[model samples]
Target: MKKKAIVLLGNKGKKYEYTRHNFGWLVGDLLSEKMDLFFRNEYTYSFAEKRIDEGFIYIVKPMTFMNLSGQPLKLFVKHKKIELENILVICDDVDLDFGRMKMRPFGGTGGHNGLASIVREVGTNQFPRLRLGIGRGKYGMVDHVLGTFSKPEKELLPSLLSKATDAIRDFFILDWQELMLKYNTKVSV
Candidate 1:
């Protein structure tokens, strides 16, 4: 069987930690824990790999900052010889409501810089993605994505993170379409 990889993009500095933009990192961290994997610096990012029943799963936290995430990602993909369909990107979505997740097979960046970088480097927006909603309101779209979550938002974060992690695991067992139908929702699990 072939190995499957998932690349997660997020900022590198401490200032970006816990911010809404780091939601992808948050999910990656949680998933790493659940899978008993630890990240190491490699290919311009912090990455971890684990062998699951189906194949190897890789979690990447890009060190190239948000806007230039695709460079490292493309390198990793080519070096590992993994196909685009085997890659699932997790990112924060401003357009989605808080706690909601959208599983897309392929689409535009939807105004996400990290995603935009990926599309640019890969020359297409045809890979699958799992988008986590951080909510948009008083903080405005820009501030909301770059800002830290509120106390209430933090309270609901763990559950949502767990669900997103599960959704990714489900991707290993089911195709993106099936996983989206079962797990995509506004409610927190």
Candidate 2:
């Protein structure tokens, strides 16, 4: 079976924990814990792996800061010998409303620094990606992304993250087209 990679675009350090910029990491961390996949610090990521059928799923959290997310990702993919097509990058998107998500087979970076870095490092924007919504309001982009979830959002984040986790699992069990048809929308879980 082909080895697949699920790269959760995020940064390290407790200071960034639970921030909107690192929410993708929360989903990866939660899903890994729930699936009993323990992560170990290796190379430039907090890496976890699990075997499903004849294939393997590698869940990774890049240790580098957000804008430079791809540097570590490029290294990790090369080390694993996984092709760009066989990977999905899960990241936060400020264009959609909070809790919403969208998936694309490939496209331009949409002004996202982390994605821009990934596109540059991987030498292509033709990789699959799942972007979680983190919409901007009256606040500036930096404030919106660096800010914490609201009171209601704090309560909602766990389930949302869990649903996102399920989405990752579905990436393996179901076809990519099916997964996108079902999950690529602004609807709540």
Error of 2 at 38 (Å): 1.3
- If scored against the real structure, what TM-score would every candidate get? 0.95, 0.94
Model 1, span 106-180: residue lDDT tens: 889988999999999989899989998877768467787788889999899999999988888888788766887
What digit string (tens of lDDT, one per residue) describes model 2 on residues 1-189? 778998998768888887898878888888888889999998777889998888888998888898998998899989989988888899988887887887777888889888999999989999988899878856788887888787877888877888788788787677778888878876575
List candidate 2 stretches off by more than 4 Å. none
Estimate the TM-score for candidate 2.
0.94
Cα displacement (angstroms), candidate 2, residue 138, comes to 2.4
lDDT of 1 at 161: 90
Instruction: Please give the CA lDDT of all the candidate structures.
Output: 0.86, 0.85
